[model samples]
Target: EEASKIVTPNNQSQLEINGGTYATDSWTNVTPKILTHLGMNKHLQQDHPLSIIRQRIVNYFYAAYRNQRGNPLFSVYDKLNPVVTVQQNFDNLLIPSDHVSRQKSDCYYINEQHLLRAHTTAHQVELISGGLDNFLVVGEVYRRDEIDSTHYPVFHQADAVRLVTKDKLFERNPGLELFEETWTGSIANPKRILPSSKFMDQTKQPCHTLEAVKLMEHEMKHVLVGLTKDLFGPRIKYRWVDTYFPFTQPSWELEIYFKDNWLEVLGCGIMRHEILQHAGVHQSIGYAFGLGLERLAMILFDIPDIRLFWSNDSGFLSQFSEQDLQKLTKYKPISHYPQCTNDLSFWLPPDVEVNEGFSPNDFYDLVRSVAGDVVEQISLVDKFKHPKTGKSSVCFRIVYRHMERTMTQAEVNEIHKNIADASVEQFNVQIR
Candidate 1:
């Protein structure tokens, strides 16, 4: 009984977080596992690497424009509400109703109308609507990301938006001292901000003059590149890749070379004109960016896995000093626990087969519920459709391992039994 109680913490604690009254059916994809991360702001801790990294970035902004008029180039909005209306999170960002990002598989919806913010940009419109021009927004963002060495359901993101009006653009030249001749694109072939075919609405809305927009882009690229170099040093090799985001045009992601691979740290692009006009800020050119702190911290600290950030182990947490922001300490592995692998195959029910109702997130949520953080990764190893029965077959490979200790075969077997039973009972999957 005690062991069962230890394994099932969600059953006992089902209370909603403060600040909103929720109907019984309000949440669709927000499971207890995801909710457990609601209050866990890893960057808030003084000794945390995330907090230090945030401060370092903030300091750069502060120092850059300290003497200029409208000083503090960026005002930090760290304590904004995490729960946002769907309009703010999706609709205000020009995200189409049928966009894949709006799906329950990618976002944690509190209801059809509200959700835990999937990105810090959720507050972009509200802040502009409230009369703020240049600012930085940092907060805990939630998503239904796949489990991996680099991905987690909850992560910290720093979003920065800078707006320069037509008047301001005329006054300020695009040249800044921090900008080195390091931009990959020449004037002829600048970064392309192409519109996604997924968006049904307007693609390119001109909020600023062509010259003003170009200046903003130059400044935006400089700030990002300089900041990255400051964090990782001049020797770090990095490049910019073109990408697509609903809220920004000509989006580009900054990827730094780490551990023999290019790790994407942030995405930035010119803000859509409609987004600004919706917020009552018009006739201005601006740029916005969203960066993942976990990915940045991982590379800087030589951390191997994303789960270590959440670990309470003193061995992991005690290595860094809060006061020393530039200290780059390599994390030493504390345990070499053996990993156990389990495979489960099942046939989709009629509801799933006909309506495409089943999502990998549902299965991941279930695994997290039963196994907690012990379940490291879940992969869809195989999938096929049966012509005779008209049912889809799927197989998932679940990797289980304890970070701090080795698990006996007996214990793994017991947990696997529970997982199999839960799939049948809870998910109504026909286990084979």
Candidate 2:
């Protein structure tokens, strides 16, 4: 079983050392690795001049970072990486294996057989059974990504994995309810807890369900937030959208809006049945997510240039001190204005199909555009044919944020008015 193979020392344990030979380093099953002499240059993977030199430099940086990572203050790091042997493969996360994201045109072709690693997230399935709470993997990743000020072919990824059960401390509180409420745009109903699902546990008993799954999501979110609080403060916002993936069940990408646009960060979901079977983890729940170092560096440092990561530009990196990161530990300053939340509905003729002219969904899109950072969310909370109006009406809740000063009702009203005006002009629909 895959799970057995991971935890038990392989009957065939192999370790490669010093560019020489792989040593069995074990008793019994003692078989010498038969070798033939291969020419010098043929033995090396690349002749690129700076490859070896640069690799050594990165090794030093990694060493220093790991040491600093142990400090109690640095727990939010979440990036835990372990190197793999030549024959090892890290499973791809979120995306389907047969997907174009896995094809040569989109990814680095590692070999005609195996391609360079795309993200550290590939380690998800493999490490699920490893005995650890909130484990993680961090490593250098190679992809064919276009190089730009904000792009790089070779970058780093930090993959964080967490496993929890009904017994954990988080289960006692039922969730970090207090934490969720403190943030604006958070789900306001204090009594309305995150949902869960019913699914089989490792025992093959039928138990998972949508409600339980959401509870797990909430639990994981709380764990991830607490762990990552040092780098990013409290009051994080979650952005969810429909997305597809092979190894996950009900997969979705989660983005948190920070500077301006929704800065997509991590991907997560419950593990797929096939994935659990492959991992030999029967009747168990699984969750996994990956974070891109390049993206985090950009957001944290306001780095518009992605290539700068590999620039070996000492000047660029030296600009920020480890000390500066301490500021991140504090709660992030809220937007100047208190959030203004309002809900509006529109009535349409039953004959009016969304495509016939303008619609409520379209109006919300425009609301999102003009509202920008101010637009917390535009949810189509209610929609149906109006019983009395003899028309279809769509109800939406809008939330706005301001950073400098609390947004006056008038300021919010102005934006609301624009949304209303656009709706009226859009489909000749009346606002209810």
Candidate 3:
């Protein structure tokens, strides 16, 4: 409303040479417009560091952005990705015209040329070429959905992609030793070369086996745990549980138990072939994962609402602890241990809901709220036909670990019990 009423003389003056009328009034300078917007931001101007031509604080932020960009650990800065907006089309992932995801209910289609992104899976597609192996991306994503305690129309997502032969997801790579200087103060991938055995012979074997899935799950969980350990300076309760997503054939959700409840923090799975083809990748088995970034910020900082990250409130922004910043900047030893993965599936009704009034995601979330610490990771191993009940059976692979100590079966069972109970009592869902 204000834009139309406020005629721009400055813009009009430029247009006059092009034979346009000069407006009665206009802010002759453009700088004021930028300032006005900044000032108008809800609370951005409140207690924010002054914006000047040059300031040390400003320099630090700029430097941080660059340094974060330069670091491979900061996947958000991937050169192949170039940090695109959520609504833009991914360059090459194959899209079936009749695919259900194209529906307005599943994804936002803006005319013929644009759509709000349904997932950050595209980063996995954009970053991988047949020649390259591992990388990550962190950025905002958009969705058209009803907002609630957990759902949001706009959210942040972190996409992690690794190009390796399928076998690599299972066995220890001796060459992994080169990662001493990576964020863990340990070298990781001194070079980008991946083991040749992963694609052809190794990955074809099921990651569903107890032994196979465990190996991959460990590698997946370590990415998050290592990040937390380095930043937090010590042990923190965490776990993984079976979760669902479209991109990964065998996908898992990572969780962190906080404030006396389990909270979901991330997602993981092996990359689907169609996704690989879209990225122009051939001959490599890929492991990919993505999750809402706002959920992460909530878990890390204990902010209640998903909206707070974008709140533009200096107070909320200022609340991130010195410890949090230290965690962000601190270094830790690189983990060289091998990862173990395991898969387990149960007969579950497709109609199950987590709570009386909530949705499936909500129920799954409630389970996580209760059991996040015990489960190291979660993924869907199978879905569709239920052999016994003849109902839809969803499969999940469970990953478990403790940073302070390796887990014993009895201890793992106790944690699993809590999660199981949540499923039964809250959602009336059974786990096979």
Candidate 4:
């Protein structure tokens, strides 16, 4: 028997997902290809390797908290909640109103008020408002990202948070005590301080004390280290790097050594007190982390490409089974297809830098918009400066290949023509 085909709505005015209807407007950038991924809940499905990996991480943390802190594990919220308000996704996290991430090119908006959640952290405040102090929310997030082996428009993130305060611990158990030592070192110390930006200072809570924040930061690292070791094996080589995020102060990212490179696995730090305060937890400080599970799974399972997670081909997916977590199954390539290449060069306007308006990313987005997923890679191969005109010229090479099948030269030529025309019309640059 053949698999069932999904019925897409003919109306562009609204989108229906998991029984919820969102009013679609002109700002909607979600493509029909991406809409099919909604409600698939691959992370929650049985036998899905991504889902299995998520469960393994949850298990590791659960056991750690239970044994060390004498507290039960957090409740798991794994579902497809694509719809969230603008306030919840950006405003709740204290993101600036004019942040570039809020742009239509980078996000999928269902009107001005609602959008597909871009990160699992989008649901954090709602959980806190509902009286949960600790929880793990695993779900799909949307982005209008560039097309590549590693970049996809939709992916999964696991966001976990814990609210802590000395008073709350004493009130609940009367036995737990806050540690006294505080970190006193330069920001260069990866173990002691997270990477700082101007925003970190701007967002730090006035209610926080050096001692309290130090202890909370220490606890956050301890839990994350333990969890990481459990999932990647005890002797796994990893390092901490300073990073920045809107919702967390002194944010750090965890990078694990894999394939002879340091692959960033997660981003975390001391939770901004403003977030907790808005959630009605006025008496506590907390820490939170959001990690991309697909990146980790790619390393663990030796999955060659991010696109394989969406494959229905039994040959590609049958290698993984939910019954096994430690089984490292190396993915085998089914077939390699021929590649088609195209190049475009354009002149830069005098008013801006050589790299200003028609950025590589903008060009990539334009290519994906016209060619869909068939276009694989884009590269800036050549550049030149005209001595007389004082103008700069740049050339880019575009690679086109389909994962499962071959593409006709006619189809590729049409896409190339469209991209060239769009580049001229949209970016206002003369073709050379």
Candidate 5:
């Protein structure tokens, strides 16, 4: 299946992406606007807020963990290819074939068999299979998502994985054993207490021993808590909430109190033993965590709009640095441009199947295709089914505002008209 390719209806011989060419199919939905972001690597730029946060986390791990050779334990891979096979991105991660994330509305598929990864976790199993025990994968991820202050089609993510065997795990705690009924001695924090056995059983995989799971969980939380402290300072308020992921057993999400609201910053848990076994590592237990770089950068730098991270304006780019990361400097707003609001209302095509009907994401993509980043936020202001007619209608409010400059009403009108025309031509909708 991976080797098969279908020519697009346009009859283009090949589509270029990140310096490589590939055959496109009906499944191909990657746009030129999205493709333009492929090699941007904003996370690598020295003065970019995303890059500053990435380096801060990298430095935290380097200082916190050490390998047997007395070197930094977590190897960093920040320049990995954004394109990956379906198997690598989904199957290897234990995601179900029928998962909603596999749909074209959720992911940016390059073809039937390949896609731009939606998360950095796409590389976790491959890295483990290649004999990397502890590593960080940092790169841009793509998705078809709603337009808002915090949501963007492309964003950066950091995924961290660490593996430890019985010998390595017990080596630092010489007196402790893996199967001991209750061993709290290994916990470095004297004030902390282990959870009840019932809780442990509920959180751990049956294949793992309680003692081993506790030790691994403790280490994972210790390192991650330290990371949060390192980035946000020792006084940051945070809590862990139980969560679920396809690739991780005993999953959790960490949320920090920021700006009077609890914001989830990362999701992590013990790596599924089956995943390790599949990677040819039978005797090791590990933990893996993935966090959005933009999420952290926004809190640390007070970045309001997600689009500003991609801004080319010197005012936005010049406000961050490695030094500023230590000081936890807030980003000063450059200028607020006046927003132009336009509403796009249309009725569903009568012949369209319910399951195949146009989605808000389809409309969002159309707006993006016509106006690019000039359109800031899109909201479904009204949606209703017509009485007796069995027809659906939707009204979308698109806020158009440029990050670096004010957009003229005339310019916005033209863009909005283009979006409306494109919607009618593409979805055969009657505009209201």
Candidate 6:
């Protein structure tokens, strides 16, 4: 009975996550609220907006890419475990040991060695090593982030990887040369041309011919562009911006103009040869891409807040359905609940530097620990530096509202007081 307990004192508790029990340590920061979300698998819920968007993408992949037998080429894995080891989450993906993302403040570590994966890319090398050539991994990812309308600690991501051999690359285009100097005639969009630049030069690994790299890049852009068009229609305004990642060379982020703003949709690039070599897959090169499902669903469904995605309210859930997967129906406004606002101000610990000692995310987590999901958004409203003592004081405004019903001012006040007290106790911040 003791072993089956859900939580105990710090470092004494055994957390049961997805049927596996892990001992907690100083690095354990995953909240019970976060743990409870593990099995929700909102992405798999048939009538959920997330599942509808996922299915739409899955359908596009099925119809767009097919093998010789007319079967879908990309296998989908949506049930991968959310918990992963440090090696799988960071080291295997070539993330630097000292990378800022490795900080406990940025990730929900179950312990030093295990954590809720921050991205679906954690399974990339594992799948490749397991002999999957073309695949998609969709799962919930966790992060310690700020409270806002668009950001949530738990969200879903879809990651896709497709590999092609030299023979398979030229199988359809028999006239195409493997070592062609430039790929111009095959691509329909001139804007898709690989520009001559330092970045482009770096992407041309010695292990792959220029023609091979160009072919892969072209195919990747084609598939992604087709996907965006399929989701947003052919008239959607979108562009490709050059970006960098530790695991991929010559990475690019796809941004779409939606709701009068340029919103980034996804990041993709050709797989680094070394990553493939590490996976024991030789003579095959591929491209990998990942996109946040909530970002897309929010835009498609006109969701006003990211927190609404997790709402179990029938009003929110009933607005979406599996039958309307292809329709871009705007989400109807549910009843508008009045918001209660509270402000918290505190001084940074005097002993440490402001930037080194304090992280907003830590304060955000502290508030979350005390208030849970009743708080909708937290914004830094003011910051002051005492000229004499060189001390920093910061103020944040928290907006509290319940999705299902109105939150009474008295109820919000109690939660707000608890959050303020917890902030002081946990962060050593002097209340101001």
Q: How would the candidate models be sorted by lDDT, starting from the highest? A: 5, 6, 1, 4, 2, 3
| Cα lDDT, model 3, residue 427 | 43
lDDT scores of the candidates, listed in order: 0.76, 0.46, 0.44, 0.75, 0.83, 0.83
Worst 10 residues of 1 by lDDT: 183-192
Residue 116 Cα positional deviation in candidate 5, in Å, after optimal superposition:
0.4
Measured with C-alpha atoms, the lDDT of residue 175 in candidate 4 is 48
Residue-level lDDT of model 6, residues 205-301, one tens digit each, is 5556777788899999999999999998899999999887766766889999997899998999988666787888876778999999999999889
The lowest-lDDT stretch of 10 consecutive residues in candidate 3 is: 48-57
Clashes of 1: 1
Give every collision pair in model 6: none
Flag the better candidate by lDDT, 3 or 6. Answer: 6
Considering TM-score, where higher is better, how would the candidates rank from best to worst?
5, 6, 1, 4, 2, 3
lDDT over C-alpha atoms for residue 231 of model 5? 85
| Predicted structure 4: lDDT | 0.75
Measured against the true structure, the TM-scores of the candidates, in listed sequence, are 0.87, 0.46, 0.45, 0.79, 0.90, 0.89
* TM-score (C-alpha, index-matched) for candidate 6: 0.89
Count residue pairs with overlapping backbones in model 2: 32
Off by over 4 Å in 3: 1-101, 165-215, 228-235, 277-280, 321-324, 327-432
Candidate 3 structure quality by residue, lDDT tens digits, 319-358: 4333323333211212222223444444455653222233
Give Cα distance to truth, residue 415, candidate 2, Å. 51
lDDT of 5 by residue, 300-358 (tens): 88899999989988999887777656876789998899999999898888845334677
